[model samples]
Each structure stands twice: as structure tokens, then as C-alpha cells.
Target: MAKIAVVAANGKAAKKIITEAVNRGFEVTAFGRRAENDTDAKNYIQKDIFDLTREDLKGYDAVVDAFGAWTAETLPLHSKTTQHLADILSGTDVRLLVVGGAGSLYVNPEHTIQVADGENFPEAFKPLAQAMAAALSELRKRKDVKWTYISPAADFQAEGERSGKYILAGEEFTLNPAGESVISYADYAIAMVDEIESGKHIQERISVVGA
Candidate 1:
């Protein structure tokens, strides 16, 4: 079984990922500032993201970075934490899977502009989105680290049923038949663990949309 460590495990997305991974029989360790009130994983570690050392992450097969920040002031933590992980996992076999935002996804075929740069993008969420974009950029430059950044659909729903169905795409934004860019957190978690097991999109940015 793959030994997986999920950072920021208390978050909604992380919780779903943890549940899905546990259900799939993967050995999971939950890492966060506090223990999850309800978690299936038997192992739990409470520590600040930056405080995690290479030794602390040594044996994990893969690390799922589910860390997120909502405010502009704390947005820089996204890139900072990503860089720290990259540095620590540089020569190790441990793969890093980042739960990214949709902001960096391309808005057009040319891929000249990102969804975060589009006019309709919400202003309030721009800082957080930009932070995730920066994290992706940082990951892309880490040649020594195995990393995969998975961006969710444009409309990422926090509450929805897990359909066990989704469409995986490259850097460009993906839309469903009805022209909607959306995916529930539950399904997104399923997609994430699937990618972790497959290792199909390593060292790249991929997106998940509703099927």
C-alpha cells in the first residue's frame, strides 16, 4: 500500500481526499495545525506547514498538499509552503501532489491568458488564486522534485455528491456539455487519489471538471 501524507488535512478538500484515500486502502497520515474532529486515518500529526522537515516526511510515498489561504495577507504562504516541500523532497522518491486552484488554467487555446486574468474572474478571490498560480510556477521550476499540480474546475462546489465521475484535462480550462466548468469537492478528491495511484501527470499541471 502507498504511504500517503496529506498536509492541511483539516480542510474540506483535504478531508475528502483523506476519506477517499482511506477508502481505497491507502495508508494515510493526516497533517495539520489541529487534529481532524472526525477522520478515518489512524495516524495524525499536528504541525505548522513550515515546521515540517524532510525527516518528518521521509517514508511517505507521496505528499498531497491541500493547504489553502483565503486572505491576501496570508496568500504568500501557498508559494512558500510549496517551495519548502520542493526543497525537502528534492532528491527523494516522494511525489508531491498539489491541490491547486483554477485561476492558472488557460482561458483559451492559445494559452496566452489564464482564467485568473479574465474579466469575469471574481476580484475578492484573485489574491488566493494568484497565490496558487505562483505555487504552480514554483513547482514547475523544481526539476529535482516530482510534483503534480491539479487545478479544480472553475466552479468548485464545496458540497456535492461524489459521482465517481470526472474529466481530466491539461492546462486549459475544461467545460462540460452544458458549458459549465464545475466539480464537487468529493469528486475532486476521488480524482486526486486516482492521480496519486497512477502517477500519470507528474511534473505537470492538470485540471478536473465534472463529467
Candidate 2:
């Protein structure tokens, strides 16, 4: 079984990933600022993400950076936290799988426009989106660490249905058969765990949407 560590494990999306991972029999350890006794992961580590060292994550097969910050003042933490993790895992074998934002995914085949650049993109979310895009941009510049950024659908629903099906795509944004870019937290968790076990997209950014 894969020994996985999920940062920001107490969050809505991360919690669903933890549940799916645990159900799949992975040895999952939840890492966060606050320890939740009710968390579904097999183990828990209470610590600030910035304070985590290489030693703290030495044996894990993969580290999922499910860290998120939505407020205007805290948005920059996206890039900072990602850089911190990359710095600590520079020369190691552990995979850094980031739960990224869809805004960074290109909306055109020419690689010119991103979802964040679309006219319909929400104004309130631009800061958060830009911050995540920065994190991904920075991650792309690193060659020492093995990384994969998984961006959820443009419409990432916290309480949406889990149909046990999804469509995974590359850096360009894609819509499902229904012509909608959406995915539920539960189904997205399935894709995350599948990627962890398969290691299919190292050093790449992939997107997932409902089938």
C-alpha cells in the first residue's frame, strides 16, 4: 500500500480525499494545523505546513498538497506554501501532488488563454485563482522534484454527487459529454487516489471533470 500524507487534511476537499484514500486501503496520514480526532485517515500530524521538514515526511510515498487559501490577504500563501514544500523535497523520490485550481488551465488549444482570463470568470475568485496559478508557475520551474498538479473542474462542488466516474485531461481545460466543466469533491478524490497509485502524470498538470 502507498504511504500517503495529505496536507490541509481538515479541509472539505482534502477530507473527502482522505476518506477515499482510507477506503482504498492506503496508509494515509492527515497533516494540518489542527488535529481532528474524527478524521478518517489512519494517522494524524498537527503542524503548520510551513514548519514541515523533509524528515517529517521521509517515508511517505506521496505528499498531496491540498492546501488552500481564499481570502485576499492569504492568497499569496498558495505560492509560498508550494515553494516551501518543493524546497524540502528537492532531491527526494516522494511525489508532490498538488490539488491545484482550474483557473490556471488553459482555455484554448493555442495555449494563449487561461480560464482565469475568460470574461465569465468570477471577479471575487481572481485573487485566489491567480495565487494558485502562481504556485503552479513556480512549481513548473523546478526540475529536482517530481511533481504533479491536479486541477479540479471549473465548477468544483463541495457537496455535489459522486457518480464514481470522471474524465481526466491535460493542461487545457475540457468539458464532459454534458458540455459542462464540473466535478464533485468525492469523484475528484477518486481521481486523486488513482493518480497516487498509478503515478501517471509526473511533472504535469491534469484536469478532472464529471462524466
Candidate 3:
């Protein structure tokens, strides 16, 4: 079975990914700063994201980076952490999958207007959004590392039913039949794990939306 390690494993999205991976019969290890003992995984580790070494990460088929920071002061950690993972996993078979933000998604077909620059984007979240965008930029520069960034829809929700249905798009924001950009975290997790298993979008930034 494929072994997967989920960083920031206790976060809502990470938890759902862990559950979904385990349900699909993959071996999962939950890595978090707090290291909860109650997760339904094969293993759990409490460690800082930067402290993870190539040796420590060996044997896992893939690693999902579910880390997030809200404040402007802590937002830079996003790029820093991405660099660390890229440095450590460079030339290795382990793939890095980032849980990215929608701010980087292009608002138009010409690739002109990111969601972060859109008028409706909340000011309070712009820092975090910009930080995630920076992380994706950094990842793009690492050609030796195998990585995929999955950006959720602009209306990504924490509480919604897992219909087990979603549409995946490349870089651009995906909209459902209602012309709304939205996706539930549960379904996002499903798409994420599906990519890990399929390796369909390696070295690409993909977006997910409700079907």
C-alpha cells in the first residue's frame, strides 16, 4: 500500500484527507505540531514543519502540505516552508502536494486578474492569500522536485457535504453549473488523494470546484 504523510494533519482539510486516504486503504501518518493521539491513522508525529528532514520523510510515497498561516507576520512562513520541503525532497521520489489558496487562481482566460486582486477578496485574508501565492511561485522554480499545488475554489467551505464529486481545473478558477466558484473541504480532500494515487498533475497547479 502507498504510504502518505500529511503535515498539519489536525487541520480540518488535512483531517479529511487522512480519513479519505485511510478509507481508501493507504497507510497514513499524521504529522502536526501538537501531535494529537486520537487521529484514525496508522501513525502520528508531533514535529515542526521545518524540522522534517529527508531522512525523516523517507519511505513515504507522498507528503501533503496542509499548513496554513493567517496573520501577515506569519504569512512568510508559507514560502519558507515550501523551500524547505523542496530542498529536502529534491531528487527524491517523494512527491510534495501543497494545499494552496484560491488567491492565485486567474479570474480570466487571458490569465489577467488573480482572485487575490479581485474586488470581492477580503482585506483581512489578502496577506495569507498573497503568501500562498508566493509559495506557489517558489515551487515553480524547483525543477528537481516533484510537486503539485492544489488550489481550492474562491468559496471553499469548511462545512459541507462530501458528495464525492468535483471538477478539477488547471490554474484557473473552476465554476460549477451555477456559475459559482465553490468546493467543500471534504470533497477537496478527495480530489487531493485522488491525485496522489494517480499522479496525474505532477509539477502542476490544479484547482478544484464543486460539480
The lDDT per prediction is: 0.91, 0.93, 0.90
lDDT of 2 by residue, 100-176 (tens): 99999997789989999989999999988899999999999999999999999999999998899999899999999
Candidate 1 lDDT = 0.91
Instruction: Please report how far candidate 3 places residue 76 from its true position, in Å.
Output: 0.5
If ranked by lDDT, best first, what sequence of candidates would result? 2, 1, 3
Instruction: Specify the highest-lDDT model's number.
Output: 2
TM-score of each: 0.97, 0.98, 0.97
RMSD of each: 1.1, 0.9, 1.1
Q: Summarize candidate 1's per-residue lDDT along 60-87 as a digit string, tens digits.
A: 9999999988876788999999899889
lDDT of 2: 0.93
> Which of 2 and 3 is ahead in TM-score?
2
**Predicted structure with the largest TM-score when compared to the true one:** 2
Candidate 3 residue spans exceeding 4 A from truth: none
